[model samples]
Target: MEQWKDKVVVVTGGSAGFGKAIVDAFAAAGATVVSISRSPDEHGGNGERGNVFSVQADVTDDESVAAAVSQIIQQHERIDVWINNVGQSIRVAFEAATMEQYRQLMEINFYTAVRCSLAVLPHLEKSSGSIVQIGTLAARTGWKNIAPYVTSKHALSGFAHQLRIESPDNVHSLFVCPGPIRRDDAATRYKAQSNGLGDAASTPGAGVKISGLDPEWLARRIVTSIEKRQPELVVPAKARLLFSILQLSPRLGDWLLRKFAS
Candidate 1:
């Protein structure tokens, strides 16, 4: 908490989901939080700490994103940490989905992070701050349905790695990969987007055999990781074994998945 007392943190898509959880966590930790979302009205009131501010911006628009950064810098004078947490996911078979649909989802899930991160990077560099890129297990593992989301995350994972490799010692880019985040409507969140995938479409990660993580718990871990300057955070720690296996050999990874499924 003390670590963030004097810092200025900016979170994109902080109106809901993991983004909102992260905003609350940082505010509780005493950091001045700026939450930028499309519908800032829906973002509601500030946090209990009275340190949260909301900004409405279309993250995919270069000018909108730049203006939001300008506004934050003008008001706060500096940015100590910038978090790119805005993302959307959909469930559709690769064949059933169109290139246009894929592009649209990419705009929300991938390019939003790219734009927000690039816009705030100079200020973060000035403050020797950190950049947090929220990702999902989809970034590492290829699951049935949701090729667009999976491909976007894979790009994000690569981007985060490049950022970390290129960032100065004092600046850090943290990539977080977690399983399904528990949501109130988790059971049917993807009903309309399912494209006839049935029960699988109604579940997170297309009913991947994994537990949905509590968003609040994951947010807390993210806050601590920022303070520790951790490069990558994989929740349920044991999940890393699977990611490790996937990387070592695709054949072995498929065998393990098949074994686990059986």
Candidate 2:
């Protein structure tokens, strides 16, 4: 905890959900956390000028992201951590998904991270900081009826890997691959988008048999991983079996993916 005291941490899409949990966790660690949100006033901050500050920025737009990064640099001087946590998910079969949907998902889940990472890379280089990509188990493997999401996250996972390969030794990249996070709207958020794909298609994780992860606990684990400079982390740990099988035998991996479906 003392290790993070006063360090500048920036997280995108931190107004709510698991990203908000991350903001709270970093603040608890005594880091000066700047949470960038598309709408910062909505359930963002308490108006207390504490260790956490919320800034309004649309990460999808390069100019908006650039402006937000500049403002943070002017105010904080240096950024010790840049977390590309903005992500979106949807339910649609690859055959039914539109090019527009693919573009939108790619913009939100992939390019947002790329823009934010590029915006802060120089400052991070100066501070010898870390880049954290909040991804999911789907980033490692595929799930049904969410091909665009899986595709976008796969791109994000690759970008994180390339960052590790190219970044200097002082700069670290942490790619987090967690299981489905429990949310109140999990049952219905994508029901309308099911497109005759059935309830399993609408369900989070594409009805994968894995239990939902607690967001707060996941956030704490992420902070700890950042501290350890762990390159790639998969929650529930057991899920690593799928990635291993996929590498060793694609046939067995496909069978396991089908077997894991609820």
Q: How do all models score by TM-score?
A: 0.94, 0.96
Can you write out model 2's per-residue Cα lDDT over 80-105, one digit (the tens) per residue?
99999889999887788899999999
Q: Which tens-of-lDDT digit does each residue in 1-93 have in candidate 1?
A: 778887999988887888899999999999999998886466653322379888878898999999999998988899998998888888888
Residue 153 alpha-carbon offset, candidate 1, angstroms: 0.4
Alpha-carbon deviation at 208 in model 1, angstroms:
1.0
In candidate 2, position 219 carries an lDDT of 90
Error of 1 at 121 (Å): 1.0
Residue 140, model 2: Cα distance from true site in angstroms: 1.4
> Which residue segments of model 1 deviate by more than 4 Å?
44-49, 258-262
- Candidate 1 TM-score versus the reference: 0.94
| Best model number under TM-score | 2
